[model samples]
Target: MPQTERPVSMIDPSLLLRPEKVYDDKPIEAFRDYSIDDSDPIKERVRRTYYDMHTNQTVDFVKGKMEKWLKFNHFKSTVKDALIKLNELVDESDPDSDLPNIVHAFQTAERIRQEHPDKEWMHLIGLIHDLGKVMAFYDEPQWCVVGDTFPLGCKWGPSIVYGDDSFKDNPDSYNPKYNTENGIYKPKCGLEQLMMSWGHDEYLYRMLVHNKCKFPKDGLYMIRYHSFYPWHAGGDYKHLLIDSDEEIKQAVLEFNKYDLYTKSAEVPDIEALWPYYEGLIEKYMPGVLEW
Candidate 1:
């Protein structure tokens, strides 16, 4: 496996620079608010996206997606080229910013760059973390390609956005075998043991591994579990965690703050920023990757 040049500190969350309220100057607590508001188009879009995801994303559905995408046979493109394709995507599940996903990618990388000037690997991570959403252009829908992912085949985490109402129609919600807290997993099975709902997080993480990209374990963990709000952000999956997951949780939380808060910040000049990021891509994940 490839390794990052240096270790990213997960011990102190205080080390990461944070603004008072970064999402378009919204309050910190207001960033992820999922309150129902039919009158609001963005809120309604976010609601409908999750509703479609929760209703349709069954164990079978996830398995089928895995069988399809994990093959990595659809296309091959350089990391930079793949990221450029995200210029066409807007995460329907996000109410924070309607800008193309590429802007968010650069916003995320630039913030990480400003905060942790030495961790170039993390800058690349922030840029490409959502690159798995490129699946959207290739026959995949936004519902499964973008959103906060949770463990499937288990009782939905109460902290998941709209978990109370969105999953009511899902067949897995009613299955006796899958409705338990642990579901099909053993106690303390850890994060990797669970079948998290399919999304860009897992896909890009696995892409790194399969392609032998040189990123450290912590950077990879940040990519994989950053969207697992139910565990890292929501505090709902403790019963299934082991001791080491605490370290993983801290790494993810460190990354998550930047991911969530920077959505509405001033957009960075992506053209001038490309040369810097291209060098980082060359260093960490160069060459055309199978996707």
Candidate 2:
């Protein structure tokens, strides 16, 4: 791994200034310049992931997964423990640099910490936002644990990654019940009632809710929909959302700047940073969680 020549504390979140700002110029250039058009290289890794997801993420598949993972009987882990363990996996769906995820965790936290130092809860949210992706570390395929998520039972969103090419293999793509816009859901059925495709976002959202973590609605929203690029980033799936959902959508959108933009070749000083995060963990979600 390449470390920045300057101290990591001065790392810029978005705007690149001096040449020394880039640890590896390639990913930073992609981060700064690449578009998500059909031809972009970012779509290369996303293609296979969405292909498998679109094919297998049927209503029945999501139901079966919800029954299993929703029980929250998987294992016991604290927030800190789970976030640290999340480092073991890499997100194939991510076009960003494939560093251990703890770097991203801290990178996100530090970015928020820099901008809104008073919103300590937001800082914690940034750090553990993708800790839900630990599902990949637990034998879950990269396709399921990480990706741009959309609702499973309803008609697929046009902005979903690989919107056309991938869903051809999906059974739901043909099933008349799921083919139409609105499918089984009523207009403005609300995101809470719908089952999103089984992924770490849903997993961690359920975990936090079940554990009774005293986080604000925004924090929870950031956790759940951070991967929901189709809804938040792509501007698709507005029919399913109610007025209140817009608040959460804005929160997720603001959170996305840090989550999507913070990837780099540089890593955080984990040893120096661990103590502060442990303190935050104790303050909020202390003790072993039945994750």
Candidate 3:
């Protein structure tokens, strides 16, 4: 069957899922390289992280996570404090960056600020997009807190980082109800309708909503789906989408370029830039918040 395409102006839908593919002068392929290399410690770490994630992130596991975290009871802190805590986390699943997650957050936000100068909400979205990784500080494993997320209770996408080999031991892969293309979802159910695997993307998205952060729907969409590479980047899951997901997909793709491609960019002066971002926090989502 022919594939459905995202809007052409956003990004070409024909590009192969190659980490080495260049965008904005940096080789993005070098960024997401998941090639198995026991000799390369970073590559090995990336492989192991995904293998663990794919192996263990089943429907029940995600449900348990939701039950645990969705209560917003984990802890309370301002957005800046939470983001600062990420300075201690190095995303084991990422091949391109070994720097503190805080750096990547600022890199993404600053890049967005440059490109879309007037959209202050988008700049904040870039800054806090991965802020949910603060879960690592609370005892959650990196497997659940980092990396790309796909819908649970559905056939794993072929474009997922490690693909089927990594999910060999996952019970979901063998379950008839969860392994089909449509899985438990009706046709045209839309991206929002899918139960995404437990990860920072969903955590932060929900936390924002729970705390009454006032980001617009597209900003929220960018936060929630930025790491959903299989749909926005790989063109998978077309069978499950409604027509409106097209706009959501475009928003995600727009935010995703800065999220992925900025890892190699020069780190911004995070301390210097804080005053501006702090104002944004006060304006949008201020004060101590529930986890």
Q: List the candidates' TM-scores in order.
A: 0.91, 0.85, 0.92
Off by over 4 Å in 2: 1-29, 32-44
Span of ten consecutive residues with least summed lDDT in model 2:
9-18
Highest lDDT scorer: 3
Q: Name the candidate, 1 or 2, with the larger TM-score value.
A: 1
C-alpha lDDT of candidate 1 relative to the true structure: 0.84
Candidate 2's displacement at residue 53, Å, is: 1.2
Candidate 1, position 270, lDDT: 94
Q: Give the residue spans of candidate 3 off by over 4 A.
A: 1-25
lDDT of every model, 2 decimals: 0.84, 0.77, 0.86
Score candidate 3 by TM-score against the native: 0.92
lDDT tens string, model 2, 1-291?
A: 122432332122233321334434544434422223366666556556667887889999888888888898878988878887877877777766578888988988988898888999999999988877878766789888887688877788766655555688888888888888888889998877777899989998889999999889999999998887767756677888798988888898788778866786368898999899888888888899998
lDDT of 1 by residue, 1-291 (tens): 111221221111222233564356666645655666789899789889989998999999989989998889999999988888899899999867899999999999989999999999999999999999999999888999998889988888877777557788999999999999899989899888889899999998888898999999999999998888767766777888899999998899888888988987898899999999999988988888898
